[model samples]
Target: MFRLNVTTLCAIKWDCVIVDEAHRLKNEKSQLYKACYQIKTRRRYGLTGTIMQNKYIELFNVFDWAAPGCLGPREHFLEYYGEPLKQGQRISAPERFVRIAEERKQHLVKVLGRHLLRRTKQETIGHLMRGKADNVVFCKMSDLQIQAYRRLLRSPDFQLLISKDLPCTCGSHLTRVECCHRTAPDGVIWSYLHRENPDGCECCPLCIVLPCLIKLQQVSNHLELIKPSSKDDPEKQKKDEQFASAALGEDAVLVGGLQQDESFMGMSDAQHCGKMRALEKLLETWLSKADKVLLFSCSVKMLDILDRFLVRKAYSFCRLDGSTPMGVRQTLVDSFNNSPSKQVFLISTRAGGLGLNLVSANRVVIFDPNWNPAQDLQAQDRSFRYGQRRHVTVYRLLAAGSIEELVYSRQIYKQQLFNIGVNGTSEKRYFEGVQDSKLYKGELFGISNLFRDLLETVFTSEIIENHEERLTGIHRTSSEQCAKQGLLGEHAVSSKLEIEDDIENSELSALSQEQDGIEDEIESPNDTQSCSESQYEHILKDAGVLYAHRNEEVVNLGGAVQKHKRPKTKEQICSMNDPKTLIPSFVVDEHQRLATPSTLKILSENGQEDDTVGQKRKYEEIFKLEEMDETTKWFLSGSSLCPTQSIDCCKAVFK
Candidate 1:
């Protein structure tokens, strides 16, 4: 009756109804929300730690269900509360609009205060939880992956997908005057799967925007996921073949245009993917220390790759995904927790992120990032929450300078949105020019970033520095600030809740101390010194890393201060081989530095450097060279300037 006749139960009148995980009903259009709305009750109660996740309308839905007309009609609430509050959060919104939005926000909060009793985990159970450190690992893409990525960008289908002004590349289909080179022509409409070419039928037979994106994401993780296999369902394979042709062009090799070399295909899974290589190193270190791990990925196909890799390594692991039977899930979880042989528990972020407590595993790996930051945060909490023991360390892996970075930047945006709505804290506007709504531009928003040719610089200092600053800001919110903002309710001050909170906090502290002792025994002095640095330094040498910080020291890059140059020590100055001694230290103008090209070559129509235009190119190259690379060629050509000042050292090695 509970499963099949939920609506029938709602028909009967009741004095009250209580809802758990009430945020699920945020979408008013959902069947659960509809069923819950149909229930006849005067008093409706909703309970959820996270009442609002992404948008403001969510608050309205939860509130309206609890008390009819409390937030007024949906349209009224949106007009007064939603739009104004969102507008004020924007960096560019007018002063008047910001003022109006603030007023609306205050009123909304006051109204919420009457009905809502919100309490934070820190306040209620801070004593019971151990210290959890979140480290963001930016992994570089394999050489094969980079080639495939560039191949997709060069495809005609990709050009048609992003409706923005770009130099026309369609050979001979239209003249220089009529080449649809400007922003897509008026009335051009694009569906999620397919896009209409502005110049009509001359474009590729299939222009799929979504598939192109999925392919890039797949390449970032593992090229084998997109590689055609006989195991694929016939219809799915047919669709994939069509997409491959459209995305990579008919003449190009499939799956990032990988070479059909036996050597390439015969490479080990870790050798084929950069993230896998990092994971391999981490597993080696962790498993040796007898530390269990919970690894999560958004893609089930990626999990299959991991499963195979684990089998090759002869590592005992248990897996759970959407396909895992409900009855067997608990058994698998118990086996992983109780059995010492089970070294790792692999989980699908969507399937295993919630409800399950894997307290036995102290380390967690978010193999890939999700667009929704909440999903990733939830995955981290599985190990960190009211756990049995140990300090939880979460490693969030991202493909540096790829589409994954864009996804993560948006995650930061969405998180700021959540903070504004719930915690009443607003962050400095980082994505100022990058509009997420319409006419998207800037590095974080549009097609220009996707078509970026230079892999040398993935993220500008402004982008990565701002990203790190914003993350730090989010985690540093104090309980006093929350109280001043009225997020902490009257109920939180109750003696019973306060007593429980104290007990939990003490337990958490005790667990952390115990874990510290264990970690000290496991890692040696040198290992502890470099514990914060990326293990795969060779591959990530040119990648942008978002370093974590602890005790005023950068925690993810050998505990160095994140800067363009670190103050040189006297011992470092004695070695003439040190690049710092080779060139005079000077700060280059960021704007002028970025504008200068890495090389003095000019690409002609056919994508080849043309020596034929040497006269004009020669003068330009000479001018650029005189202005740039004087202090250090390494600084001018480095991938990112946010963390570590090793560019001079790298230059010294070459000299």
Candidate 2:
């Protein structure tokens, strides 16, 4: 009744849908078949070699969708085609139903033949040339699996045995016919009990029953002790000897009953490891020639083993399992489609089988087959869809005689059931009748099929030898040719610097000298006192050469020095009290104004006068003489002075 959205249906319009191991969809009640039915598409296809399995009804779900309403409803079809039977009975299909199924199948083939394609590797690809197919059979279980199975089987309180109450704990009151506890002791439990608890009680008698019976008895006894006592008194004991007798009678009657034997103990880790290694070797051989491949497995754990092998061989690949995120699943698909270097795409059939296009790959490998043919076919169609250029080849690597083969056989039978239009009720009835007998047989380990599968590869040593030879050749030539051609040229350098011949060193030298001169000029104040007179002379000589080359303005040293001096006023006294006036503004000007004999005499007299009556007396005498002639004194007073301009201090002093 569920409907798909228009957008989703539109997206799938032209896309091809491949139902892998098509036998699985034989049952119309399967979720896979229901989902496929909801897909709206024109190019529908199914890929399965074992299309006709045990029962015809197996193909009902597929044909129902491929050609809707072609197969009649469950009741009408069964009424006409099937015969009723009792429990543990199989209903035989009539000739009419078989003909209808065949006709429907033929009609489906006619309608969708162009879209559908299937080819076994043996039929199409012939013998693979590059890689070896190897099979290794390991006869050991992982430590954990072994321990867990042993714990379950050997424990005195295993649920199945305890529920049956096989030990007869009431001291024998009930008759054997009515007693619920009726099973023989298994060997493993008996061995443990006999070794540990030597004192065998009446109820725990040693018997020559099957090992499973011993297991059941041990579990029942454990359950009896743990059962709640009826009386309120904590220490109350049963005093009825007759009750004990009855329980004993029940035990006696049930003592010889048959049960399943203990045979699963034979499955060991060594066995699994050996078989897995053989499978890995086989896959390696197949991968050697394939440019792209898809490996399908039911168990994620098996996929993990293949992943490890691929990693060891340095093959680049991607893995998708039930846990893969939906968003990332498409990315992995796209990567597989586009990447040439990635050779293997490891996918769990359940996770990556539906809605993925992998037509770029021409090779498909099924590592292990599942009960559902539809699931296997869906997984294979990932590569065999539209846009697939080459003829797609599928390799089904089945363990010839293990539980895998048995499951495969069941799948085939289920497909047949689908073709017959068997209803869910009928299927369930069939399953219930055969569930205990067909599924749970007594075996030390139900791995005989697995052993036979590995033995097939062992017996055929030529395949392994051929694979090894091919692998050796591929490895030998592949890397050597790539290595001989180096990555770069011998003369290649990382960086190169080019030099120009036109640049002159003399110009640079001249610029450096000019910089040095500017630096010296900045330091001239400090060097002025440090330099000797001879050094000054050499500097003047260098300045003269530089001065002569340029049309420089000639500065008069006498006139420039005269411009810097402030003329001394005749009215001012040059004493410590007038220290500002005593210090000459320019030494050259002071010396020049005092250069005349009369002026020198006056200055000398002023100095000599300081020793007698102090320098004040000399200044007083000069001022007293100046007071007699106003005009002469005013003329003699040096007041008109401009330090930056030409000064007439000589005329003022002489007048």
Candidate 3:
């Protein structure tokens, strides 16, 4: 009917066609794009809150519709402009390429700036809103979920997904896809069923990349998502049963198992999920405080799980997802806002991420993250936007050291790219690649990293401090301050800070000769500070919180809420700005145990150490490192090596 109406609509020869939410026209190959293009019009205009979400190519598609050929051919634009900008943004990119990338970025901005009319949310709606706090809550997986996750990684299906792109071990110099794994031993092509495929066939021996990822993601959310739905075919159901049984035990095949039984007094099904357990605690606190909550998940199945949990807990809530009727969504939103009894609004991220005014709910919990950062951002805006009176707090619950971390990492990567492209902002190049890949692997992209377990203990204070600096825009303290803090300890505490200030000159002059070249390296803009394993202090109070930090509150001036620079105490600065300085001298000496021989020599000359035997042992370790393979050395180097550099270094040396 839309096709027929579209033809009649086009015949009218409209004078103008204005498109709202114009980013939808990003895919020129889409039917909607083609249909919209058929309309006869002399003047074309488009409006969108987000013109470019994940890539520069999206901007090309939007511009192509508004003013055809303004940005030139897609292939030409991508090659000459997009690719260079992306390459330049890489952490491992050479200094020369970074210059070229900046040049390309400036040129593209010039071209787009002519037709683009941009206004940020801060500019438009800043006056109407209060300060918002964003918090990332990392939830530890349940014992069952952890075992199931590890087991799934070793499954044949997952192994095949990862192995297909690897250089064949047979030394064929061809990828497994091009060589042995191309066809099965039975001469049948290897492929898994598409997640949306209605007519299920016999389970294939091999798995597709996307389906395998969905399975992994499901395990992180709730094991119930991995289980076959009731609508699935019997064959598919049987295969899913076997798959779950193989990863988990046969007892896990019953979804929530005996948790439904009133007689069963063990942990509830909701408690079995790490995210749900966190949500349970949060909801208890928030509801008791009379604070409304908006819960969002990318999966409707996850929403269903939440719905059951809410019902079992006897909490009043409203739900909106893809299954909800278009007309009814607004009604649900209005009811949630007007009725104080509706303490929770269960929303699917994709379905309710946009065009919803959920300001009544001051607390938002993102149960799962989306690959696209914009979706998550939009969801946050539902509560944090204009007319929100109460201070909004957003909790992004993620499984600790799991696929969710990788997903969140990619979100930050894309967000940096977006900021660099649209806002003309400079960002720290923390990743090796701009895009995640299935065919190739890097620090941020790889099946091996995704599958491997990350020790909560391995990350250093520098990692947290760097992250805090990026998010909160606070300057870090100098190494001199760090050394002073270490030496002074609690003895330096004084009501009047003038005493500490008075000692600054003497401290600097006395340490000038001793610190020499180390100060320059420590102060380098691109260089991130490194600490030894013993200096790896726990940043989060709870092991479940893989990482947690909050942005400072914005100052309300007139009606606008904007961030203001404020004075901070020594403790606040150490905790928020330079976490590494909190490490004591003992930890530093322990780190010195792994120092290079040059450092050992300097330490002896400075009379900082008298243990010559330990120094000798440290010097021998350097020789041992030289003898070890590059891969082994990378493992030993730990946080000292830049992840971007290691990818290239390991690839060249190993193969």
The models' CA-based lDDT, in order, is 0.57, 0.39, 0.60
Ordered by lDDT, highest first, the candidates read 3, 1, 2
Report the C-alpha lDDT of model 2 over 391-468, residue by residue, as the tens digit.
444555443223343444354335434322321111211121221234432221122221222222222123222323
The best candidate in terms of lDDT: 3
Quote the positional error of residue 324 for candidate 3 in Å. Answer: 1.6
Q: State each model's C-alpha RMSD to the native.
A: 20.2, 48.5, 16.9
lDDT minimum window of 10 residues, candidate 1: 552-561
Clashing pairs in 1: 127-504, 127-505, 128-504, 128-505, 148-256
Model 2 scores worst on lDDT over the 10 consecutive residues at 547-556
User: What is the TM-score of each predicted model, taking all chains together?
Assistant: 0.64, 0.35, 0.68
Q: Best candidate per TM-score, number?
A: 3
- Misplaced by over 4 Å in model 3 are 1-4, 183-207, 250-268, 436-441, 446-543, 550-655
Q: Which of candidates 1 and 3 is the stronger one according to TM-score? A: 3
Candidate achieving higher lDDT, 1 or 2: 1
Report the error of model 2 at residue 138, Å.
13
